[model samples]
Target: MTTRDALKIWIVEALSALGPSTVPRIAQHIWENHEAELRQSGDLFYTWQYAMRWAGQILQNEGKLSKAGPGRTWMLI
Candidate 1:
């Protein structure tokens, strides 16, 4: 799958594991869990953390996830 698709899946999985999380927390989880695969994405892999936020935005738009509270934490819908 493309990086974006993979990121969306990772985000969902992270949320399932952690219940709800901030963007950085989700990003860290994805990095810790999928570092090898993410590294395979080449130079762009360095930007994966930032890409998680975009993935969150896409998920939010698709209504598969939601943001809550002042911290804008994310959780499954």
Candidate 2:
């Protein structure tokens, strides 16, 4: 899968595991759990953070995640 696709899954996994969490915290979980995979993901190691945000938005649009308010954590729908 592409980096953004991978991030879509990871974001879901992060929220499933952590229950609503801030973007940084979700990123930390992905980094902690999938560092090896991410490092081998071509340019993703550098762009995953930005891609993660995009993935989260996509997820929200897909109804897999809730809309995030200002300074709010991401939640599953």
Candidate 3:
């Protein structure tokens, strides 16, 4: 798979592995463990955020996840 696809897989697996997390925590884990795959971000996340919002929206829409807080914490539904 390409890097973006790998990132989606990594994020899903990480969410499954850790349960739930603040976006920064998830991003930190990705940066720490998957550096090889992560080296290509080129600062896009800091500027635009990554796909976290998009994923949460899709999951929430699908009823697979829900907002856990008024802000960024999300949980499986």
Candidate 4:
């Protein structure tokens, strides 16, 4: 899958594991779990923080996730 696609999946999985989380928390999870694989594939041009933000936006657009409260937290729908 493309890096964005991988990131999107990671976003969902991170939410499932952590409930509502801020962008940084999700990014950290992605880095911890998938950074090596993404780097090996030469697809990690952007930081995991950026990738997670984009993925969260995509999921929000799809109605599978939502931003919560005021702290820039995201949660599964």
Candidate 5:
């Protein structure tokens, strides 16, 4: 899958696993959980900022997620 696609998939999995969480928190969890995968893939792994913006855009576009109180935490609805 493409980098953005991989990010989206990861976000979905993380949201399901952690429920609502801030982007940084999610990124930390994913980084720790998938360090092996990241090492094999190199820099396309995406940082916390990209994950946050990309996921919010993708999920908002798809209507699977929503902003809650205009903060970092995203709500899956």
Candidate 6:
């Protein structure tokens, strides 16, 4: 899948591993664990952060993730 599409998977994996976490922490987790994949993602490497935010919102809308709460951390539902 494209890197933007991959964010949905990676975000869930990060939360499952790290528990509820801030956006930056989730991003760091993805970077640390998937740097090689990101490097190969072309334009997505530059836009992943923005795309991740959208992915999170989409997940929330789909009821797979909780709505943004205090501290703006994300959690799987």
- Cα lDDT tens digits for candidate 2, 7-72: 999999999999989999999999999998898888777899998999999999898998575577
List, residue by residue over 11-75, the lDDT tens digit for candidate 6: 99999999999999999999999998988888898889999999999899889997475798899
For candidate 5, give the lDDT of residue 40: 63
Residue 5 alpha-carbon offset, candidate 1, angstroms:
0.8
lDDT tens per residue, model 5, 1-77: 23556666777777788888887777776777766766566566555447557767888799987667357587678
Runs in model 5 lying further than 4 Å from the true structure = 46-52
Best by TM-score: 6
In candidate 6 the C-alpha lDDT for residue 17 amounts to: 100
Q: Is candidate 2 or candidate 6 better by TM-score?
A: 6
Error of 5 at 59 (Å): 1.5
CA RMSD per model (angstroms): 1.5, 1.7, 3.3, 1.9, 2.5, 1.2
CA lDDT of each candidate?
A: 0.86, 0.88, 0.61, 0.79, 0.70, 0.90
Q: TM per model?
A: 0.89, 0.90, 0.59, 0.83, 0.74, 0.92
Residue-wise lDDT of candidate 4 within 1-77, one digit each (tens)?
Answer: 24668788888999899889888788778778876776764545556567668788889999999997469689999
* Candidate 6 wrongly placed segments (more than 4 Å): none
Runs with alpha carbons beyond 4 Å of true place in candidate 3: 40-49
Worst ten-residue run, lDDT, model 4? 40-49
Q: What is the full ranking by lDDT, best candidate first? A: 6, 2, 1, 4, 5, 3
Q: Find the 10 residues in a row with the least total lDDT in model 3.
A: 43-52
- Per-residue lDDT tens digits for candidate 1, residues 1-77, read 23777889999999999988888788889889998898888765878777878888899999999997459989999
